[model samples]
Target: MDATPVAPPTRAADARLDRIPVVTRSHRIWVALLGIFFTFDLVDLNTFAYVAPALRSEWGLSITAVGAVTSVSFLGMFLGGLLGGRLADRFGRRPTILGSAVFYSTFSLLSAVSVNVEMLAVTRVLTGFGLQAMTGVLLVYVTEMFPREQRGRYQSLTLALGLLGVPIAAAVSRLLVPIGPGTWRWVFVIGAGGIVGVILSVRLLPESIRWQVAQGRAEEAEPVLAKLESEARGILGRDLPEPGPAVETAESGNIRELLRPPYLQRLTVASAVMICLILGFYGFSSWIPTLLVEDGYTQTESLNYSLVLAIGAVPGALLAWPLVDRFERKTLILGISLVVTVLLLAFGISSGAVLVMVIGFLINMLMQMLVAVLYTYLPEVFPTRLRGLGAGCANSVGRLSGAAGAFIVGGVYSGLGYTAVFLYLALVILLLGTLLALFGERTTRRRLEDVGSAPEPA
Candidate 1:
């Protein structure tokens, strides 16, 4: 079903990959390994937020200071997005993925040994960088390797696996952070568990076959392709389907192609969507526990509340699996954005514990659905040669806003109070919905080459 490009990349080759009915066993192993890697990505990403109360009591961190640390780490994510995308574009997705796992895991371990806020902030910056870098490339890898029709949901499936990290963070923060002094260190130690993922990835993951042919390294793609074909054959209990009809040979292009006509439009739309989404999503999620404490809830009560809300993440992603394949991705994102806006407004105004929990859970579910769909869509908008770079460009710019969001939300919460901050988040998602409605392009179930191609004349 997949292949090494024996000649230059051909329509025949792309057809072989596109028509594969199921993931081969060889490739499923990689998917499981990648799921482990991203699960840890979520763990390291949220560790700081979950442990904020402990940091406040033990190290005297104020909300303003938490904002500072959060902003700086997001800035690191901004850089990592750019750097990782470029690396993946040039060096290939496999190495970039493996290399970034090492980069982040090392820094996540370093987080456990931080002596003070400054030390923690420094470690967090590097950790954030590696996490984003790893993330951008992984999404690109999925875009290239997975079946075209099923790509969107597969993206969500991996994310659903990764979202397990949310509950992991919640449980550890609740159970371990309360055990007196220095216990929060145990949470960071667990965050460093990406090292285990990296080891598994080294053994189980294959170099991306599509990326190889895109770079004209057909020979290198052969062995991996053979193993995948064998597995796929066994699963089918017969010979593979004949390759589909070939279209024109799709010429590969680089990042400059995105700076030109069709992709530039898509890039702008994606960046706008991501910026607003980051503000709304991160504005709420990044500040939840800390804000609960600020509202006069005890740390223990806040963690209990957070743990309940974190459980929503898995269902949120799972809920999208069918829909992601069923609808146009852009339309789905716009619809979810509208729904999240309404829920956020309710979250802002509610006071009773039951009402608040219900609203929060819905918001978490819809937001994950939005995120899973959006990640699937991002890589689809660009050509394979520069897919990583293009997605990273938009993603990094959005992350820059994500950094700003910590400060913006913190300042708004400090000056105007909690309800006003949620109001602001409502406005942000509303803006996101408007942008998608206006400029978002459709990418559902299209070939990567065709999806990224310039429009045909009417």
Candidate 2:
């Protein structure tokens, strides 16, 4: 008889069988660091809006110019998300993250020195490119670190923690605007400080062993995995199993891969949900303070109202943490969409200031819940290799929709009136709810591969 030849184990086969030990402490620490980084990114993105009144008054900027400044960064984010994912796939997650931090930090500092709208716009665009790239890589890093069963909970928690930046930014803006001559500039300075913390912490963190293994550098991955395993044993008080092999489904990280059969359908649903969510979120959020001011509130009163709105988001985010893992993601999304739609319409039609504040709080709450659900859903629907690329693309598309929302609300607020603009927002939310109810897949209790495989025909 002829001797039988043995074949090498494929990456997918190795990943399917191997079970890495879980170290909760190290995982939590890493998640905290990433969350802090994301917080800074959010601060940088929204700080401009918080300081918009000051900037417009100082520069005599038209409403169109203010909208343009906000939209420019989002346009850069759209491009960054697409390119950044592919770069992370090629160069490794750690490098992409660090590079983005350095790039955005530098540009944020530059924004403080801008003398004209053109210069400010350019700096924001560059800052946005780096900010979005870091965000894309961080999502992949967080998702890959956890097991499929705990992915939703982990993602939701981190997202909630990251959103703490919203209130922090708004608070800082309110406090500084009264004391400083260039308070908006100071906001950018604070954002720069946050990036410095990220740069230092990220250096001490380990690269993803799964990513290393996928690149066929198993020997390099071994030491990292061994260290992680040792940490796990310390926490769990038992020896842990080895991690399974890394899987590589596709070599190309191009946009074309997202359009391939299974991914295309998932992408479409994710994009639609994202677009509608942003329309609802930005429609009210971007104009909340202005609306309050128009309703006879002082600047101080408007700022306080905005703070209240930001505070409401904290509970919404926390509520999602446990339920994200417990319920169907689609159901959560659909439920929040309906709640937000109703609250926003009620807010628009109501006449009492106290009632408006109460309704605004609820709207903020449900919007944050919708966002938590979305972050959990998008990443869970893609394989480890494609997670960053797919999620980034979906997020980028959503950012574009949000930019449109800013323009639409700003344009119509003068001509169509605030009530009309809000009704239009309500209509968008209704359509989004319907789409999610009908097309969104149930992802709770399912593995990433299973979720990815459940996509319908494109």
Candidate 3:
């Protein structure tokens, strides 16, 4: 086994670390653990959507009432994003991950036991809080742990694997929800999938090497690096490559740093991206089955419609692997949003069962691709010191927008009908592209230490 030096690379964690190529034993393990962790997140994410129609019938709730439940869940996510990143930075990524798992697991169980919509909404809020917290930290962990050159590809790979959970949730809901009146409750039980994920995480997940060194814990990073080198050397069948040139990195900064100059503009762009994403994502994806139900489809019919649409999620995420590293991150985000905009418009005007299915599939496919790319692009904008908090704040803001979007879409659908809601969604997506195109800075192929919202101070 190759012995790791006692100290971290002089410049920062990326200096010697980037010399290791994209794949290694450690890389695969990290990706697998993150993927599994995110898998349960996705499963829980779509659970309420799948159960909404049944919820309407059993609870005798209005469509707006159901939308309000979804809205409150976004409010919960807003709190989670606010806390997830700052907590990760202050506490540690692995501990944050574990804590989030425990929270979602407990609340999801509470969600299942809801005797009234009030109880369900409250539990769903807590569940959303934990889920978003884990999500924000995980995004930070993925970018920090992986090799710099192929960060986007690996992120896509992890998400593609995670995309499996959508179909799993869809299929499970389809199977369990309609079995009887109370079977819908069983679906929330599935959200406990995090319990298994947390177990796997404890066995395999390492604290992020970059985060460790950033926290002035090089001793902690060393053993992890040594194990990685030993595994990588076996794969390479020779000595490791020479270290790359070092790039400057800042010492740790407090959460308030995200509000200061240099980072403020980037925070604005990131927040815009998050808002646009939530507006589009919550308005459409979360409302799919409910949207169909509102349009006169039966509960069973809507669930079937969503299950078919779920087919596109995996391929959409997998498709990002090739294009993510190929194009400039900012330009690529704009391009994908353009396609998603057109697709959303097409879906709104679509008619006939087959046409609706086809258009929805295309919209979801491209949307997942957009999601994978944005995750890679967003973190590249912040300094390591504040990356998690910045991302968390941005995501929290988006979740706040998402709460408004759920209400806005439901109100629009009720007032103007389905087409108007879609038009509103398309507009939000276009705004996302426009904001990023004008203000987003470039970060393609540059080392993380070298890239920033503004040039580093001399």
Q: In order, what lDDT does every prediction score?
A: 0.84, 0.73, 0.84
Better of 1 and 3 by TM-score: 3
Measured against the true structure, the TM-scores of the candidates, in listed sequence, are 0.94, 0.89, 0.95
Candidate 2 per-residue lDDT, tens place, 1-37, comes to 2122212233343253235435367677777887787
Write candidate 1's Cα lDDT for 220-266 as tens digits: 77666656556766787766776665442434556777788887888
- State the local distance difference test value for candidate 3: 0.84
By how many angstroms RMSD does model 3 differ from the true structure?
Answer: 2.1
Residues 87-158 of candidate 3 have per-residue lDDT tens digits of 888778899998898899889988899999999999999999999999988888878777777899988988
| Model 2 misplaced regions, further than 4 Å | 1-23, 233-252, 453-458
Instruction: Candidate 3: count the clashes.
Output: 0
* CA-only RMSD, every prediction: 2.7, 5.0, 2.1
Q: Pull out the clashing pairs in model 3.
A: none
